[model samples]
Target: MTVATARAHPNIALVKYWGKADAASNLPATGSLSMTLDIFPTTTTVRIVDRDLDRVVFNGAEREGTVRDRVVRFLDHVRLLAGREDRAEVITENTVPSAAGLASSASGFAALAQAASTAYGLALDDRSLSRLARRGSGSAARSVIPRFAVWHAGSDEQSFAEPVQAPPIEMVIATVDAREKAVSSRDAMQRTAMTSPFYPAWVTSTAQTLESALEACRSGDLERLGRITETNALRMHAAIQGSDPSIRYLTPRSWAIFDAVAQLRGEGVLAWATADAGPNVCVISPPEHTAAVAERIGALADVVIARPGPGVRLQETDA
Candidate 1:
């Protein structure tokens, strides 16, 4: 059988997804929007054959247990739709920094959904593939599209619809701490959902933030997007504080980078900081302001500034 492949790039949420309403369904506790990155993403290839073996390889290493199980679940879903249960060999490669809270799972699962469905000859649309990807991670649903994407917290089956339009916006993600985090997004959200007293408040506030951010995007107002995103991230962090046996993801360096951004803003640089469930910060600015943002960030610490780019799509081998 010929191998069918798909590639998906990861997205860093400007309005971060912190908690979950339904963990089993991977539904977010709140709706969120993200900017797909240019450099960091995952590529996956799947080949189906009439064999008894099911296999998966990640970056040349054979995987088993949870990772393998998740792939099988995705493939199984594809099989049901295609009306054939052919065994598949799955391979994935990540160009992003792993376990650094840079949305590795978002790109990873999105690629898998695209690759597996395509391999099985399922002519799934982006929305269909997004729903499949959401089964693996809530944020992954948004990574399936490029530019700006939103994950609406509606019904599990009806949620991952593609937007009719997206704004021209750009974000630069700065890796404050590119190391394995003590709390994974899954575990952190699970704990927050069950334990945090302010979880309800966070949800209500998230709706407001989502509306404001969407308006900002539509207006092509980067300043408005920046302010709303920064505020939303801070509120998400507050929810963590309200969690019992309180947990925090921000490192000193993370705050240092944040403070530097603030300082630059004070100096008239058009930049703002937003964070997810981890320490890394994503700075949002207009395309014209990206160089100024990068120079400002460079002074704070060693960081990479990615300009606004297209969403996840298949790469041409020769191009």
Candidate 2:
């Protein structure tokens, strides 16, 4: 028997990944930039067992359904890579809420990929491990990279995440609604891609936006970076709203938070707001203003202040 455990941090995309280029390979339609957060990480342990079926426990509960299926499917791929037929027993503990657009899957799959590959005796490199993690969650690729990372949009073999240099910035995440979103990001992205007229524009403009954002990061221009992050996020949500049925993840509370950020900006505060595929909002600011931003947003909802975090790391291994 072999056992391994890994921990990974969830990332908030500054330049969002709202759609997939190739659904089968889970490739992003366009490149994205993100900062892996230090708070609310997920830890996963993988153990090879002789049983035919894999067992999965999440947050101390017996996990079944799509969540469990995703873990098992990832394990199956790991087994295939290692040329081992043994099933796995997966134990996951997440500080972030699952299916809530908080990038829970990003950290979850990153830890799984690391732990499962180690336990299966696959000495995969960082890029290979990122590619494998991408199979489980698209943003999981970025979580495999330390601190700020960029996920390149490319072929299955070419697409992966690499660390990027950025100035010191902090995030204030407001959990407006922590429950599972009404529509999954997968379903919502597909619908937006197929039906929204703005998708083409989004795809075309995202590449340019990413270039500008990267330049902002390189130059340590917090104002430029924050502007790009807030605008790009709003643009992605605009594409989603243009879908045939109109999928809306941002709620009134989310709007209120955005308004507060705008208000802070009007008052000479360097704060910018962004969100994933859910109702929660994240405000990015310099470390000096993180406390004030969090305190202001905290009045509206629960706030978690986060800084840039490290990549996935193995905690233990036994053979």
Candidate 3:
């Protein structure tokens, strides 16, 4: 028997990945750039055992249902890659709020990919490991890389994440609601792509936005980076709203936070807001302005200040 433990941090996308190119392969429809946050990491430990079915213990409870099914499927993929059929005992924990648009799945699957592959005796490099993580969650690919990372949109072989150079920044997370969202991002994205008239325009525009955002990162222009981040997030939500059923992730409180962020900028603060497929808003600001940003946003919602964080890493291994 073998066991391994790994940890990874959740990332907030600067240029969001809103849809899928291929559903079966779980390939993203657009490229994305993100900064792995220093807060709310997930740790997972995988232990190979002599059993027919994989079992999962999440946050100290034996999990069954969709969460357990997802973990088991991910482990099954790892087993296939390693050419092994042994079941595993998977124990995972997260500090991040799950299914609330805070990207808890990104860190969770990243840590799982690292621990399961190692415990299953698969000697994979970072890129291959990132590809493996993507099979669990597309954003997990970026979480496998440190600090600023970008996930490419292409064929399975070409679509993976890699580290990129960027100017230093901090994120102030305003948690308006930490509970699980009503609709999963996977379901929302698929509905948007298939039904929304704005979906095609979103895909094309995001590709262009990603390029400009990448240039902003390279040139050390935080203002340009922040502007692109806010615009891209708004555009993503617009596409979601255009869906036939009108998927709404951001609520009144979320927009209230955005309004406050805009007011801060009006007062000469370099602050900008971005949100994922959830109601919580993350305000990105320069290092010097992080304290003020956090303080102001804290008045409205619970706040967590974060900086760039490391990628997935093995904490322990035993055989």
Candidate 4:
């Protein structure tokens, strides 16, 4: 096969997915909606050829272990679907920091899915591609689309692929800490799912949160969306507290910054914060208020603000 390339977006969850209903399938334990970011994403190139070697390179290094497993699984799925078993060479690069609690896995795996499917001449639709990506990482499923996308909770593959109708919405991500963390997303999710008693409550509340958030987005009510997201993140952390041996993602600095954002909201600044599996906080505000939010957030130590941006797309070398 000829060379093929694809770029996948990185998504930040408004309603978080903290566990898995089906670990092997990478099914979500809860429903979620995410906004894909423009600044950070993954770009991949895949070539299928009659080579004796199967190789994968990521960010100038040869990948191994779970990373290799994810690539192999994606390629194997592509081969199975397209009826080709040619040895493949894969190259991937990420604009986002890896393992820093950002959604690198979502972008990386989605890029792999897109590249592999393209290389193998597969005509898989978005839902089919999403299901394939989901097997690699749960959140990766939502990264397959642009703008705002939702992943529905269901019993089986067909049921789980159901899409939610939502309009495009703006999101701003603030990078508080970019260094890689000790815990991996997979490990964190499994630990919390097995140990957290509040996991049930997290799952039950997602539907309501997602419904309200979508409605808020549709009506251009940034305040409503921000409120739902902030509450959803708090609920996710509550599950972590319920875990045996209880873990928390919050740092002292994180709380300080969060409190600062809360203070701003109290001052009628229209600012709100949400977090993923890490200490970094993502804040949402209107385009007009984005600069104000960023300026306020930047006052806190070591915080950087990313402004409103588009979904993932191919990188133009000239631009």
Model 3 per-residue lDDT at 96: 94
Window of ten residues with lowest summed lDDT in model 4 = 310-319
Q: lDDT (0-100) at residue 124 of candidate 4?
A: 68
Ranking by TM-score: 3, 2, 1, 4
Assess candidate 4 and give its TM-score to the true structure.
0.90
Stretches off by above 4 angstroms in model 3 are 317-319
Give the total clashing residue pairs for model 3: 0
- RMSD of each candidate? 2.3, 1.2, 1.1, 2.9
The lowest-lDDT stretch of 10 consecutive residues in candidate 2 is: 310-319
Q: lDDT tens string, model 2, 1-319?
A: 3899999999999999988889978999899999999989899989988887999999999989998888888888898999989888999999998788899999999999999999999998999999999999999999999899999999998899999999889999999999999899999999999999999999999999999999999999989999999999999999999999999999999999999999999988889999999999999999999998998899999998999998999996555
What are the per-residue Cα lDDT tens digits for candidate 1 across 55-104?
A: 99999999999889978877777788889878988888888777678889
Between 1 and 4, whose TM-score is larger? 1
**Residue 179 shift from truth in candidate 2, angstroms:** 0.5
List model 4 lDDT by residue over 1-319, tens digit each.
3567778877888888778778877777667887777667688888776787678899989988877877888788778888887879888888988887778988888888777777788766788887877877788888877667777776646523334444334444656678887777777777777888887777778877878887886787777778898899888888886778777777877777779789988888777788888877888776666677777777764444453233333333211
Q: What lDDT does candidate 4 reach at residue 278?
A: 81
- TM per candidate comes to 0.93, 0.98, 0.98, 0.90
What is the lDDT, from 0 to 100, of the residue 35 in candidate 2?
97
Which ten contiguous residues of candidate 1 have the minimum total lDDT? Answer: 310-319
